[model samples]
Target: MTQRSITVLPGDGIGPSIVAAAIKILDAAGCQFQYDYADAGLSALEKYGELLPQTTLDLIAKNKVALKGPLTTPIGGGFTSINVTLRKHFNLYANLRPVVSFAGTQSRFENIDIITIRENTEGMYSGAGQTRALDNSSAEAMSIITHEGAERISEFAYQLAVKEGRKKVTIVHKANILKSTSGLFLEVAREVALRYPQIETNEMIVDAVCMNLVMYPERFDIIVTTNLFGDIISDLCAGLIGGLGMAPGANIGKEVAIFEAVHGSAPDIAGQNIANPCSVILAAIQLLEHLNMQDQAELIRAAIKKTLAQGKTITQDLSGSASTTEFTDAIIANL
Candidate 1:
């Protein structure tokens, strides 16, 4: 078998620590992969004076697969988002985030499993047009949602649900008010849902869905929504289980896919060596599953679950004394 090559962006702060741990686990599993490092986000801005360097983009284009750690998006910034740039450049239109409550965790909700399929390439996150009002006290920002974008992401969601053996897929929208943009999304979703009769589907407004999620999260199976709603729901589902510390995400398209941890770079705990790496490790497992290495993916997942189940070698967030490396070592040893 030919070893797959992947671009690795251990972005910033705790990003490097987590990626290092994931690499350790990957090596221990004997997974055959060649890695090339790239730079983006704050790290790239500091080293290369460019947030999303062309060199990094070139590498990803050639490799077509990447494993990225959490990247810090500067607030009120001149820099474009590293994630947004990559997604737009590669046409990675589907942002898939799966959230599940693992056993032995102290979560308020149980048996909670939801997959959020987000439109990765467009929406307000696209950095659309903005202008100042005549008063200069008010500003306006545009949010564009096209039928082409809506159709592709919705179809991708339904198809993924079918392949994964999921029976119901929920489409979320805000068409009641943003009747033009979100209405187009709702129209596309309704059009796409007709093809898969075996899989039941429903549409819900974003606000009502949020309320329902908190009240009865188990009712949801697979959720398909626009860029912004999907982003919010995915994070909420993560919090139901634990937090972003354990959430993993993937950006997939026709040609390329990038698996990433769905958390931010915690600069405060950067060198403290206490950040959890399971999210990134699980993201690698996602990458493996994407590559059709299901057996290896299961092995890595089992090792992680077993390590967490041990309950002795957990990071501070999980309420144990183990440092980042120690926790990773535990998982590697178990594997």
Candidate 2:
């Protein structure tokens, strides 16, 4: 068997601690891989003077897969976003985030198995915006959207639904108000819907979609939308299950994929060792599944599910009594 190569970018703060735990779990599971350490975010700027170095991009291009820890986008903005850059650079247009309710975790709803398929590239995130301040009282940011971007993402969503055995896909947009931009998004989605006859398709305005999500989350199986809407709704979906701490995400393209924790870097709790590693650990499971190590992925997921169902050693947010490493060890023991 050829060893799978992966670029590991453990950015500043709790990213290192959490990723360390995930690596330990992978090692114990005997996952064969070579990890190349790379730089991004604040740590990268401090060391290499660039948040996302060309070398880092080069490494990911070479490896074609990366397992990244949470990266803190700088406040004042040197780069737009390291995450966004990686996605666009590789044309990673599909951002998949699965929000499932764990057995033991505290959740508002039960049996919530929703997957948010976000259009990762293009839309307003493509740096297609103009900012102008007319005497500070009024400022405008013009967002642009294209049919090509919308159609590809919608098609990707439908194909994913078919592949994953999902029944329906809901296209969420804001076409009612943002007529031109979001209208085009909906038009493209409807165009794509024609091709996927077997899968049921629906469209919901972004606002209504949020309300429906809270009122009846089970109605949604796969939610696909533009970049900005997807960013908001994905987190909202996370809340229905628990919170961002428990969410895991993947940025995928034809050639490469990057698995990462969906939450941001918690600088305050950086070295406290109290941060949750489940998100990153689960992301590693996603990496395994992406590599076609289905058996290994199932083993890890089963161990996690079993551990959670037992309700013994969970993190603070999950309302249990265990440190980060302790929780990780519990999962490893169960495995």
Candidate 3:
């Protein structure tokens, strides 16, 4: 992990603003990296007439690591989700989203630290859906759940828990209805759970998990589920600690991994200087950890915590009056 080379995609809207802030913070902390710039979202569409260009993917493949900002996916389906396409292209079958209660943040609960590990390459998001009936009638989507996919994600969840000192692993599934797909995922998950007997394990129906997630979000430690379920639950969990404004996600493959903020690109507030930069800064922390730069990662995390706890300079979304630059400066000053 010496002077890692990483692909950087400063996407559309507030993406560039926050990404620049994070890069400055990282540089100040002496994190060395050769950044290969690329494009993938609406910016790519406007610049290259394509949403996801080959050159962008090539850069990421060459570097095998990326720090991506939020991208705007057009409505009415101009392109498949750039995020999904990148995951499928790289076989990034594990989506890791850690939702923890941050100090001085707007949260309904406390002592909330949870990681949502989603099987990224399979389940309903496998992109295996088809539309039949020429009369505009029927459509079908396939949910693939193989033994390998389920076992790998489950094991990844357990291993992460062990490394991160988590105590419980919750397997959320929809096996009550999706007997084949969800059932296979759960069955394989159980097998994987057996390997880590020291870690407590539990199974909950997807619907039930959602209800409990609201009532007692602090009870969950590590939540591992299939693609669609994981996608939904990850956001739900994010809501407990405030919102996506404080959330960061990682898409991990065997050889490559990408870290990004789970929040959306706010088109209305693109260049307003009011957009929050905490999420992107937090995502950069994850990228630092990916490169085994744990000291640098911890430094940024501590700075964020200190800045938030001080409550001196904060963003609008966090119930403060500070602009994005002011908030970012506060974080750097804390460091």
lDDT of each: 0.87, 0.87, 0.88
Error of 2 at 23 (Å): 1.2
Per-residue alpha-carbon lDDT of model 2 for 1-34, expressed as tens digits?
7777899999778898888888888887889788
Residues 1-335 of candidate 1 have per-residue lDDT tens digits of 87789899998889999998998888889887899999988888899888888999989889999999878878665545677878888999999999888765567888888999999877777754243345848666667788899999989988888899998999999999989988999998999999889999989999999999999998899999988898888888888887777899999999999999888898888889999898899899999998888888888899888888888888888777899999999988888
Which candidate wins on lDDT?
A: 3
**Model 2: residues >4 Å from true position, as ranges?**
128-135
C-alpha TM-scores of all predictions: 0.96, 0.96, 0.96
Q: List the residue pairs that clash in candidate 1.
A: none
Cα lDDT of candidate 3 equals 0.88
What does candidate 3's lDDT look like per residue over 1-335, in tens digits?
76778899999889999888888899878898778899989999999999999999999999999989888878655356778888999999999998888889877787788899989988887854332335677667677899999999999999998998889999999898999989999999999999999999999999999999999887799999999999899899888887777888999999989988888888888898988788888889988888789999999999999998998788878888898899989998888
Residue 91 in model 1: shift from native, Å?
0.9
Global CA lDDT of candidate 2, please? Answer: 0.87
